[model samples]
Target: MRRVADHLDIPELERRFRTCPDAVEARHVQVIWLLAQGHTVGATSEVTAFGTRWIEQLLERYNASGPDALANGRRRNGLKPSLLTAEVLEVVRLRLADPPPDGGLWSSRKVADVIAAHLGLERVLPQRGWEALKALGWSLQRPRPRNPKSATAEEAQAFKKLADAVAEEAAAHPGVAVEVFCTDEHRLGLKPVLRSVWAPKGQRPTALGHHRFLWLYVTAFVGPATGETVWYLTDTVSKPLFADLLDAFAKAIGAGPDKRVVLLLDNAGWHTLPNLVVPAGLRLVYLPPYSPELQPAETLWTLVDEPIVNTFVPNLDRLINTITERCTNLTTRQPEISSRTNFAWWPANRVPS
Candidate 1:
């Protein structure tokens, strides 16, 4: 006690040992406090659950630097200086856009090798390529799956114009209220859409599954303004099924003479109906070819599929039950649905019918 008393307050040390914010530092303090109470290094190690050599190192650091030394359990040497520069990294990024010299895509080792050759170095650590990417403001992201065909400039511009006009008209003609909703469908089975998960160090986690079974399809409609959704689960999707779904949707939303229900949908074969029975007071607004991005209802499929991901269903009945429960749960989460479906150009502040 007398030895450490000159440098550190005894009561202060006890208090810090009890309630220190940093777990690592608090552990070191506990070691010091036990030493102050006259325990040998070996005895302190047993009580503190630390190794004997670790205790000896702690004692050496404390004897040399006093209480301040105990605050940090380990000393951190400054990072090695970066050999890769902005211009070099930028070159790497641009060159990575095309196929690599040896392969289809650019990899960390290949990129590192390329950097070494350019800088006239004997070798560069392949691991540094990942670190350099982060430093250069690149992030690892799961790219959104999109179709190969792209929307042309004219199509996008036309959509913006159409959206603006719809907003204006809906606002101006509230009596002939135009209720715009987007609808889409998705298929589900026993297969899992596995995503990244937190796992133990150096151990990889896998979302394992068996053969596909009990397939089902879901068609849903979303109202961007009120976050209301109308959906149906069916065995298959076809023109007849679509017609039935559309009729059900019309009844669910109560489309009548007072308003026009503008239902936005994709250009699927089933969607292309020459004699499609669009119920009275309902209009089918077919989206541009190959543009799934335009349909707000496309977002609902993700929410609907959440229950089936990384999961197993033995039979069709069980899967249907699970999906229905999730659908019912989603209907209560109006705010979430609203945020996902809120199109920038949709009519603002109109009363939801």
Candidate 2:
């Protein structure tokens, strides 16, 4: 095998190995060149970290067809040739999105077999199925489990127009500095169970889900333009409690005789109660009933849950302490909240000075 490289000696082969663009091919060239330099195949295998049999095959190919045989074959960039073309790949992507026709999931073998048949080829490796799907821009994703409903086209259009109009009015108004704030409420219990996390290879994580998993309500008002936020946590979430939170939020936003807040809220039962207290300089605006899709503050719940997500707190006091700490931290993260909640139809990113 070493003598077969008589024409292309170790010096020239070493130059070719250095000049080769691809690392894998360069390795193949180096293996044959080393054998030419009087190194045994086993030593070459140990040095190259490639198996002995693969080294032998490299030598055999070089002996049969010279240096060109050591280069990449029909496989392009380590990918198989079966699913290489675009026309065959599009069909595979379409089929891959749906389950197998016989009422089960699509396995790599099934996909590879189908694609091979489509291309009029004998067979394709199961691993190539993954490459084909990836080439078509598909990914292994776990979509939101509950398939929540979205606003209808008409509803979405109407909301966009109305929101745009409100923004325009706020921008054009004279003297009075009006700011839009999206408000929402979330209930957290004393359960520390999360859906998933990074854990040791095959262990299901455990968390403290104490018997008292009752509700602890958190009400928040977020000024998307100015990155201003106010939150209140309590055991009760009625109109009266909402009133107290609104009063505190009023002071947090520097609500005075001149400056005002245009607050947006969902149509919850407590929110619509008669004589519900809306603080001075803060006007409450109700979004359409059952339409949470329009409210920006709903997005803040995922962020506020970060601190206490996978922990075991003893009682309501500890839970409240953790929740309060997270709330205080969130006030400083107004920019993130704004970016997450502020929609394209919402007002400009400016708060009254």
RMSD of each: 8.6, 5.6
- What TM-score do all the candidates reach, one by one? 0.66, 0.70
Residue range 251-340, candidate 1, lDDT tens digits = 888876766677778888888778677787676777777787777887788788777676656777888899889988888888999999
Clash count for each candidate, listed in order shown: 0, 0
* Per-residue C-alpha lDDT of model 2 across residues 1-353, encoded as one tens digit per residue: 34555659778999998999988889999898889888998899988998999998989889888988988664465655644687788788777777787778776678788788897889988877777767777677876432235556576567654355456646665466667787899988876646567899879788766656577888888877767788888898788878888888888877656666677887788887578977887767777556776788888888888777777777788778888999999989877877887788776533454
- TM-score of predicted structure 2: 0.70
> Could you say which candidate leads in lDDT?
2
Enumerate residue pairs that collide in model 2: none
lDDT of 2: 0.77
Candidate 2: count of backbone clashes, pairs at least 3 residues apart or interchain: 0
